[model samples]
Structure formats: C-alpha cells, structure tokens
Target: MYYDLMQTGLVGELLITGDNDGLKKVCLIKGKNDFIIPSDWIRDEVLFSDVKEQLGQYFKGNLKEFDIRLTPEGTCFQKLVWDALTEIPLGTTVTYADIAKMIGRPKAERAVGGAIGANPILIIIPCHRVIGSSGKLTGFSSGLENKVLLLEHEGMEIKGSERSALVM
Candidate 1:
C-alpha cells in the first residue's frame, strides 16, 4: 500500500492510504499538525483528488455521505461498529449505547466506544455522530472542536452540551 497527505481548511492534515484496489485508510492528524509521509509512500494529488473534492463538499454542507471506496482494517467487532457508524444519518446524533444496541450488544456501550475510536477512516465513517447518552459531545479522534465543526456544518444545532456551545 502507498500513502498520500493533504491539508484542508476544515480537517487540517489528512493521511490517505491505499493500494491498487481502493482506499485503505484516511486518518486525521490530531497531534503536531503534520503528516510524515513514509519514504515508500507516493505523493500523488491525482490519486486523492476525489477525496479532496468530496471532503470540501462535505465541509460546505453540500455532501452528506462519502462515495469513496474504503478498506479499513480492524477486528470483527470493530468492523461491525464502523459499519453501523455509516448507517447513522447526517444532521442527527446517536449515543454509544445506541450503537451497542444496534450491534446486538446492548450492554457494550464502552466496547462500542472503543471500536468507534479504532475507526481508521475518520469523517467518511461518521464516528463524530456518536455522542453521550445525555446528548453531550464525547471524544472524537480528530478532536472535539472538529467534531463540533462537522456537526454544525451538517446543520445540526448543538443543544445539549456546554462543550458544544460555541459563543458564536
């Protein structure tokens, strides 16, 4: 597999990995704010044009779900949780407990949260849609601020959590 990096106005740095088949991972760089592309990685803008376009549209609220192919690697349970994340509609929120129930593990809210954290594909998988049961904003691999920005871009009003209460 090879990797490429791109900087965006909304999500900062994104590390995209792929092979001959399709996209493997799209990780957001949350620390140091830089992507260190491996020596073997090929930096090809043509290979990631679609990804950039779709993400730009998403940030502008013109797109709801991504159409790019994905090949995220994870355990079976993690894959299950990530798949369930795709089912979460835009402009709405669901709790980790809700995902637990969806995966037939009603008492595995914590487990579901862990799986969500392991999601390799960030905004495309919609992990940001998961929140606390009390409608509070929870952890986001890309950071809570980006999570709030994403939710707001989707036109969802932040109503429950002070953490999401932007003074604007």
Candidate 2:
C-alpha cells in the first residue's frame, strides 16, 4: 500500500509519497498545480517520521547527507543520472556536463540535464546541486528560487548579475 504525508520545512510544504518498498517522491509544493494526492494513497504521518526528522535536521543545517531508502521510478538513463546526483557532496555544485562525465556519457550533457530535470525526489536526491558550467544556477524542478534557497542553506554563495541572475 502507498502512503503519503505533508510536512512543512525550510523550503515549504513537501508532499512525500512512498510504500514499504521505500520513498517514491518528495516534492516541494509551490502551488495547487504542484501536487495532487492519489485517491488510493493513505495519509499517514506516522509512516514518515524518519523522513520528517531528517528533513528537519537538513533545514536546520545539522545534516549534510540523507540516509533514507528511496524507490524513485524512472527510465534507466534517468536512474543513472539520479544515482549520480546522490553522490554530489553537500555545499558543492556541479554542472550537467560533469554529471555526464561521471556516468561515462561524456557527450550526453543535454540528456543529463533532461534526466536531472526529471528527478522526482528533490532535496534528498540533491538535484539542487547541479549548476551550469559557468557556475550559474540552472533549472530546478522545484524552481530556481527554491534551488537558491537550498544551496544557500548549504553554505554556498549565490550572487546576482545581469548576465546570469543567479551565479554560484
């Protein structure tokens, strides 16, 4: 059976969904269009106690890495990209090209960006750590504002400029 819960954290309200297999999604709810709970899923805060606590620690800047089990569904290439995303250390950012090279697809930078954009599990998976080769922030599924927030929360500096409004 799938279970889900809502937890308000540093970024905003998060809609977390999963089952016994593991967490399937942890999405930041920005608006009504951001998430919709399935009719068959049960809302059970008790099932997500650990996720809540860990996220709380993260927002508090007391946690750097996540140990939660995950079961994100995606294509094989996307999975490869997501898996590489998890290896990104805290307080550091990399480019899509870096991720492409990390996965042995040195020429698949664009494809890597597409996979990164498709990442379903956000903060825990650390998709927010990706930046442009020029050290500018790029697309984040939760929006660049939240991306800047997450990166800033991790102690990275975000500078603004006319050329690249958000440079890391």
Candidate 3:
C-alpha cells in the first residue's frame, strides 16, 4: 500500500509505497498540498495505525527520516534518477544534468526532467534538487515556489536570485 508523510513545514510530502512483501519506495516532495486517495497521487494500500501520530511528529519538525516503506513503480532510468536523488545529502542540491551524468547520460538532461516530472513519489525522491543550468530553480509538478521553499528549508543555496527564472 502507499502512504504519505507530510513534512512539518506543510511544504513537503513523502510518498511511501509498500506491499505485503515489504516496503519499496520513498519519495520526497515540496509545496504539494494534494493528498487525495482516488487519483494517481496514491494507489497502494494505506491504513497505518500510527500514520496520523507519525505525521503529527513530522509536522512538528520532530522527525527527520521516515519509517515507512515505499515501492515506487517506474522504469529503470526513472528508478536510477530517483535513487541518485536519495544520495544527495540533506541540505544539499544537484542539477538535472548532474543526475544525467551520474547515470552516464550526460546529454540526457531533457530525459532527466521527464523522469523527474513523472516521479509519483515526490519528496522522498528529492526531485526538488534538480535545477536549471543557470542555477535557477525550475520545473516541479508540485509548483516551483514550493520547490524553492524546499531548497531554502534545506539550507541549500539558490543562485541567480533574479536572472535565472523558471522556464519549465
């Protein structure tokens, strides 16, 4: 089943997916307010007895790492991108091209963007770390403002405060 762990700042969401076998995926998101169950936002079974309690702890700025297991279902490249995101240290950021290079696709920046947008899991995957070549924050299904806020919260520096605006 899939479940969510909302961050304390109300600016991030973590999608946790798992099954009878065990946990599988953990996606982190920023500036996303939607938590509906009917849509694709969530498809796995979710009914954790302590979900609300745990979420409260998260919202209170008391929790760091999550305790839920998620099974993110996606393609190999997509998974690779997501995995790379996890490697990004907390309070740090990386560019989409950096992710492509990490995956041995230095020229597949566009492809990396596509995978990032398709990331259903959000915050846990840390797609917010990917930015424009000019070092400006960019595309995010959850909204760019939220993305910026997430970076700020993590203490990650954002360059080009003016010139480099979001294009995607």
Instruction: Provide the TM-score for each candidate, comma-separated.
Output: 0.87, 0.92, 0.68
Model 2, which residues run further than 4 Å from truth? Answer: 161-163, 166-168
Backbone clashes per model, in order? 0, 0, 18
Q: Rank the candidates by lDDT, best first.
A: 2, 1, 3
| lDDT: worst 10-residue window of model 2 | 159-168
Off by over 4 Å in 3: 1-7, 12-18, 21-36, 39-68, 158-168
Residue pairs clashing, model 1: none
lDDT minimum window of 10 residues, candidate 1: 159-168
State the lDDT of candidate 2 residue by residue for 56-155, as single tens digits.
8888889989999989999999999999999999999888999999999999999999999999898999999999988887888877888888888899
Per-candidate local distance difference test: 0.82, 0.85, 0.64
* Of 2 and 3, the candidate ranking higher by TM-score: 2
In candidate 2, the residue pairs with backbone N, CA or C atoms under 3 Å apart (3 or more residues apart, or in different chains) clash, namely none
Model 3 lDDT tens row, 114-145: 99888775665678777777667777876777
68-165 per-residue lDDT for model 1 (tens digits): 88778899999999989999998888899999999999999989999999999888899988888767788887788888877887777776454755
